[model samples]
Target: MVVVGSGNSGAQIAQELSRTHTVTVAQGRPQPALPQRLLGRDIFDWLSALGLLEVKAASPLGRALQRRDPVIGTNLRHLSRTRQLRLAPRIVGTAGRALITQDGGRLETESVLWATGFRPNYRWLAVDVLTDQGQPMHDGGVTRVPGVFFVGLPWQRTRNSALLGGVGQDAERLIDHHLSSPGPRRTP
Candidate 1:
């Protein structure tokens, strides 16, 4: 099997599958890899201790941090050295039964697993809270449409805004803003 987009999900999936099936990780670009632990402590502990996780997306430091998401937990380099799991170049195309690569190589796989990540598409919404680039037009999740708010946006308020547990922080702030608005605004 072949996995496309070697982010966290793809790497984890490929690692697990390598035990039962041959796996190829189609890496688009190399990302910095961080071990799950450091100095006998969880990597997150260091991040929290350094306050990196709460950095705002707009700050110079946060801007630099968001430029490339580091691959966490899994060591892709070690995995690539193993016969069952190998790293491949970006997938350029597919022809019949073969998956083509940017280097003009082709891989024949019985299955292709895509973990390409997510892109928020606001085009389907009838609301006018979208920018010309088709992204939600909001100031820290508070849309001009007033009553509407968005949580779980990447860097909505901070680096952790999109995380499952972290979203509550963003939600709490938006609710505070919503309640403070002069009056209810149901439309843009």
Candidate 2:
């Protein structure tokens, strides 16, 4: 099996498949990573305690520092160390039952899984709130178009905004901001 990407989804897929079948992971870039635990507590707990998770996404420094989403709570390092999973460069193209990699490596596999991330599809929205790249143009989930709030978006308020246990804080802030505003609320 060939897994494209090295993010959380890709790593998880490779790890699970390695237990049952030979697997190769094609990664284009170095995956950002964070330790699941630090100083006897979860990393999320430390971020919350230090208020790092509450940093505004609009801050220039914050945006500059958040280059990629760091994978957490995964055994990717272990899998790599154990030699159970083989790592290769990004796939350049496909040729009849085989994948050609950037490094000139060819992998013949019966199964190919693409674990790339998702892009938000807001084309159904009838508002000009999205950027040219199709991302919502907002300041901490508050878009220029009033009454349209986007929570749980990647880097919405912090690098943690899109994480499962982290989205709540962003959602809470958006709700608070919406309620405190002195304007007529428009239902979507």
For residues 78-165, write the lDDT of model 2, one tens digit per residue.
Answer: 6777856888899999889999999888999999999977877987789989878778888888998778889888777787788788
lDDT of 2 at 71: 75
Off by over 4 Å in 2: 75-78, 186-188
Reference-based TM-score, model 1: 0.93
Estimate every model's Cα lDDT from 0 to 1. 0.86, 0.82
User: What are the per-model C-alpha RMSD values against the true structure?
Assistant: 2.4, 2.4
State every prediction's TM-score relative to the real structure.
Answer: 0.93, 0.86
For this target, which candidate reaches the highest TM-score against the unseen true structure? 1
**Lowest lDDT block of 10, candidate 1:** 179-188
Clashes of each: 0, 0
